[model samples]
Target chain A: MLKYTEDHEWLNLADGVATVGITNHAVEQLGDLVFVDLPEVGAQLAKGDAAATVESVKAASDVYCPLDGEIVEVNEAIVNDPSIVNSDAQAAGWFFKLKLARPADADGLMDEAAYLALVG
Target chain B: MSDTTELGKTPLTALNARIGGKMVDFAGYEMPVQFPEGVMKEHLHTRAKAGLFDVGHMGQVILRAKSGKVEDAALALERLVPVDVLGLKPGRQRYGLFTDQNGGILDDLMFANRGDHLFLVVNAACKAQDIAHLRKHLSGDFEIEELTDRGLIALQGPAAEKALAKLNPDVAAMAFMDVKDVTLAGASCIVSRSGYSGEDGYEISVPAEQAVELTEALLADPDVHPIGLGARDSLRLEAGLCLYGNDIDTTTTPVAAALEWAVQKVRRAGGARAGGFPGADVILPEFERGASRRRVGLAPEGRAPVRGGAVLFADETASEPVGMVTSGGFGPSVDRPVAMGHVATSLSEPGTRLYAEVRGKRLPVTVATLPFITPRYKRA
Candidate 1:
């Protein structure tokens, strides 16, 4: 299932790990995705904290963490080719995988239905 | 202040909105930064086919001399710039710089002698200042008029000429740097064979009232699609054209910006004779002995794009910043992250190794040859 924050970041929690990426709405606003600065594996991040930087053709935006966690893995493929975010922002364009520090906090994020309404 | 009231709108604002463009503030104007297809798609399309850009934010001015002799008008213009305007033939254009008393550039502009008048196109942000400066210094005999109600559109690509020829057949016959008065879609216009992107293109000036209609007519063609400022920036960057505020400014000299070529030999020879221009003493010497810092193109080792204000280091461990990035982004044509920066003169040569300090991480980069992609101007 998908969960989202007010900043437009989405997290797909599966088992104990969550896959993080930005929403298609955010990517569409950014125009052209040029570079993705990946967070190092094992780095601890706090809820609502900046985790990575996404540079587009015109500007750069920070990707925030949805919940406190430790980064378990990052998508090196997206870093090498950022157009993945432009083409598939929510799927194969996943930024990184994070092991949640508090599983219960995931419930606080908005569901896909709520996110759609909020973005609209 | 109310955002809508504060932001200046282009003549084609309504049309851009109708086409689903993402409008953003650019140099005080609410212009389209990109369309639904996105900047990368727009940029790549322009490279392969024709892309129409609404560059109506740029200022257009006409200068008429007292005698109406193009040569005298060119001389009067030479006082404010270092270009060899006297030699500018009718129908030809030259890129020039408006300088301050210290030889620093106030703005880089294009001057075209259109038989009966001198046409100038200045940057959007510096237009007012440039006009005021010209009025204050120019002779009373000259008349300077600002064409604020005119809209400028650029159609650029490998097939730009062919596409534009369908609208104005004479456009294909025009040579590079040539300008002429033409009527398209029943509107009187001035079309010039010049553009910022290193592609064969035309810059057409039309009345503001007919801007939307002309744009629609051009877009009606299967080859023409609306482009935005986002793609415009990337295309110019790939072509190695400098952005005024980022790549150059009042603090930057033409010499440091690697624009000395714009200063012709006649200007240098007539430096002392031509007394009114700014910073003649300081600029002329730098022409002979190069500036301390020069603008150079940089190609990063990987996909990590370096942005403006990023520091450059000689070694990887966050050494003292030798220079700073000016304009940088992914060059759509080259499919690599390219950047322009001002580095120490000694390190400005092609193939020089450097490191860009981006967010505390040292990214390896090398000085690369410019016009990162070759320009395709129609010379003949």
Candidate 2:
């Protein structure tokens, strides 16, 4: 199932792993992505922690951790070439995979309907 | 995002919105930050073909001498700025600086001698202060008339000449820094063969009512694209041109800003006209002996751009910062991250290594030569 954060991060939960990436709305507003900084694997992150950074030609923005978890893996492709995030923000642009602290906690995140309405 | 209600609208605001400009508040003006083409493409387009910029928000003024002689106006203006204004021949312009009592730059400006009067263009944010500075000093000898009925625009890039020549063929014969009264699209314009972008271009000041017509005529060309502030900043940063308030301010002196070349030999020590402008005591000495710190280009060793306000250190893990980046970003033309900053004079030499602190990590950066791309001005 997919979930969203008010901060514009989207996440997909499968088994005990949650895949995270910035929302398409963020890519639209960021103009052009020139750089991306991803978190290191195995780093313990709390909810609301700044885990990654996305830099456009004009400015930089932080992508926050939606829920407490351990970063199990990160997308090195986004770091190598950030334009992928602007081109495919939801699927191929996923930033990291987190081992959830509590798998059931994923239910607390906003659903597609709620996320869409909030962004609108 | 600021409250757009209070933002000032330029003459080109309506036309800008019609062209997909993402209007934003810049220096309190509702100016475009980018269009649908985006900053990266807009910057590249300006480097390759042509890009039109609405610079109406900048302050424009005309200075005429009370004695009815242009030389008197030029001489009176010399007391405010450290440039050889008297040596500025008619039909030509020169880059200049307004110095303060402490030898710091008040504002950087361009002044052109139009045979009978002087034309000056200054930054929008500092326009009021700059005009006030002029009035307070030269009111006794000159009539300072701020051009409120006009708007300014620039057409820049490699194809800028070809695009602009389509409107006025005489523009093709102009050289860098040349200024002339020309007719474009049936409107009178003060056209100068100069621009902030490192490309060969022209800055034309036109009647406010005719600005839209003039802009539309230029954009009608296949090569000219409407650019916004985002691309303008990147282009100027890549060109090693200083943007007021970001790169040079009251805290930075012209000498330390690596703009000594603009301070002509005629204004220096032992010259015909020496030590006349404000802060000459402090600025004059720097020509012989350099300042404590100097501005230099920075090449970030990583893809992440070392942007303005990033603190600079002499080495990794250094607890104290030796300098700070004044301007930086990805250079679309060079296809690499480029930046400029001020550092301790001893560490200002090209190839000298410095570390910039970004997001709690120290990134390696080298002091590189400025204008990451070689200047492309069509100098005679």
Candidate 3:
């Protein structure tokens, strides 16, 4: 299942783990990406806690965690080349994989149709 | 975003929208912050090629003698600013400042001697007050005309001359700071080989209705790309240019701002027209004895950009701030973060190590000479 947060972060959950990344809309709004600072593996994050930071030439923005989890893995590739966040934000540009402590924490998040309406 | 109804639009607003400019509200105007290429790419592209900017929102005013000596209005304007305007030759431009009674800068502007009149271009945000200041100070046989029907455009970069010469061959003959009247695409225009960007470029002032056509003609060249305010700000910052309200304000003087060069010796204490302009009492001594605080360029030790208003400490553990960063950002051309700020005279020397508190962390910064990138001007 795919879930969205008001801060423009999106998560895909399967087998007690979730893949996390910013939405395409958020990437478009941020313009160009120059740097990305992601949380380290084994880092514990609470829902709504900041997990990553994305900086463009003009401004910096924070990416918040949608659900409480322990960071199991981080995408070092995106850190090496930040443009992937702008080019393939939803898939190849994923920020991290987390083991969800409580899977039901994402139940209140918006679905794709609902998220589109919220953004519009 | 406030009420969009209150924001003004430039003549190129429609064109900016068609080209994917992300609009933002600036100085009560709906201006383009950047295009699809984004700020970083646009900034880099300008350094490599030519970039076009719509500066129509900037104020243009003409001061002409009602019926007197041609230098009469020039002499009148000299009373408000601290520049050698009376000695300005025809078709030449000079950077100037409007000073208050307390040796503070009201606004910085560019003025060109056009033989018949003195042409002035001031900051967009300070235009209203600048016009009123001119009217309130000068009372002789002079007429002030706001050229609202005209629009301004800047084509800047190393390749600017090549791109501009394709349309108007005369532009090739104009040297830096030279102003002349020319015809572009059958529309009469006033062109000057000057710009805010630290590059050899031209600023074209044309009839408002014909601006779009002239812009398209410049864009027809392969080397020219339309840039927005985002790149303009970064480019000027990298050049160490002082943004009016940010780097200089009502509280900053020419000496403290490190703009003593603009206040030529001819206008100082011993010159021909000394002590005539405003604030001569306090400003003259600063030239003799340097100011206590001065503006200096700062290169941060790392990639994290130190932003404006960042507090500065003399040492790594100082409890009180010694200065403040007025304009700071990432310099795309230099590939590092650069900044400009006012600091104590003791700490203003080049290579003086200072600490800038950014996001609650103290970052080491080195005081350096202005202009992270050297300016390339075509003087000849």
Candidate 4:
């Protein structure tokens, strides 16, 4: 059960914790992830708000929150080696975990089939 | 507005789109910024293996003397640039600048002697103006021709020679800065053993019709991948190479840009030389006494990348702003962010400490030695 946003963020919600990261398509578009600024733990985030900043070789992009919640954990490993997102964008590349305000918020996100259509 | 045509398209446009290249508008042309492999991968690939680049956007011009003597044409060109064109051997290339009367660089370009004709490559955006300026100043005995329909491709990397040798074995034997007219992949092309990426590479000028075919042929090799403008900038930046408009512009002098090496000593020695070029008065003296501001490399502290237009402070108090960043980005090969800027002469030392004012916060920065990563040009 993977979900996606139009901005290319993917969220995996399980047992009230949602793990998030950018898609492979997004990584390809960004090109050579260099530095990433992760959100502080316990910081409250609203849906569509910027959760982090990712700088690539060419430009910088803002990673938006998929659903309103508070950041509980962040993957610092990816921050040190941003290429993890390029190599394994879906699994180990998870950016952060959010404690969702409501489980229904995840329902609004696009599923794998829907996300594929949007990206295509 | 309706009469104006669309921005020019290179022969590789269709191929780039097919390969999922992220296209962007650059110098009045729609060019790929990067590809599916990403900029970092493409950049490292170029350093380790071979990376192909489409540089057809650059302007190509030919200069021939009406007197039919190569020396006459060389003399005519010497008037505009400070390089000793007469001393340049055929098949060799030299980097130079076209300066205004006040010594400000109008454009930076590469000139090569092709036996009977002199070949020039000017910046894409400045080509029209360059031709107009040369036409206005050049003597009637010299003839100028533009090769707009030709496509330019650069093959760069440590393995570039071996890759190019596979097609034209003679190219591998050519030394640095040498040029040859050869038929590559069945297309007659001008091949030069010079590139901007600080690597042993070749820049091939092919017929427009054969451009895509040549690109496809090269990409078919496992070592060759189509790189985009994004990686090109990073590669040049790592090599401490200047990007014309950003690093050195019309307002920047060659002396300020630390490019005096491009100007020969003989041209600066004589008070009244035979060739009467433009901006001789200002340029000649700067050669003796260095310019006030100099371009230097800066490495900022931490992972926060400093970018262009960021004001640089000389000291800790963040006192008077010394200069600004011209080009700044994360160098994948170097594993850190590097930047180039025009700073005051006193603060241009390799280890001088400085601060960059990013969003009102003074970020610590230090003057670092250039070529942030040493260029791996093949000398032998």
Query: What local lDDT does model 1 show for residue B148?
Result: 87
Most accurate candidate by DockQ: 2
DockQ of 1: 0.73
The per-model lDDT (C-alpha) reads 0.88, 0.92, 0.89, 0.86
Best by TM-score: 2
Clashing pairs in 4: B79-B277
Candidate 3 residues lying further than 4 Å off, grouped into runs, are A14-17, A39-45, A69-76, A97-101, B1-5
**Candidate 3 lDDT score at position B277:** 82
Whichever of 2 and 4 has more lDDT, that candidate is 2
Q: Which is superior by TM-score, 2 or 3?
A: 2
- Between which residue pairs do clashes occur in model 1? B103-B279
Top lDDT prediction, candidate number: 2
Give the per-residue lDDT digits (tens) of candidate 2, residues A10-115: 9999998999999999898997899999999999999999999988888888999989999999999999889999999999999999999999988889999999
After superposition, which runs of candidate 2 have C-alpha atoms over 4 Å from their true positions? B1-5
Q: Write the per-residue lDDT of candidate 4 for residues B1-380, one digit (tens) a residue.
A: 13375877887777887898888878888899888877888899999999999999899999999888888888888888877888889988888888888878889898899999899999988999999988988848889999977999999998888888878788988888898898889999999889999888999999999998888888888999889898999999999999988999867877888888888776776733432567777777777787888899999887867888889997668578898888898888988888999999889999998898864568888998888887777675
- Model 3 C-alpha lDDT per residue in residues B322-355, reported as the tens digit of each score: 8999988778889777889999888999999999
> How far does residue B27 in candidate 2 sit from its true spot (Å)?
1.0
Winner of 3 and 4 under TM-score: 3
lDDT of 4 at B303: 80
Worst 10 residues of 4 chain B by lDDT: B268-277
Cα-lDDT of candidate 3: 0.89
Error of 1 at B155 (Å): 0.9
The first chain of model 3 has a TM-score of: 0.97
State in Å the error of residue B268, model 4. 1.8
Question: Candidate 2, residue A64: CA error in Å?
Answer: 0.7
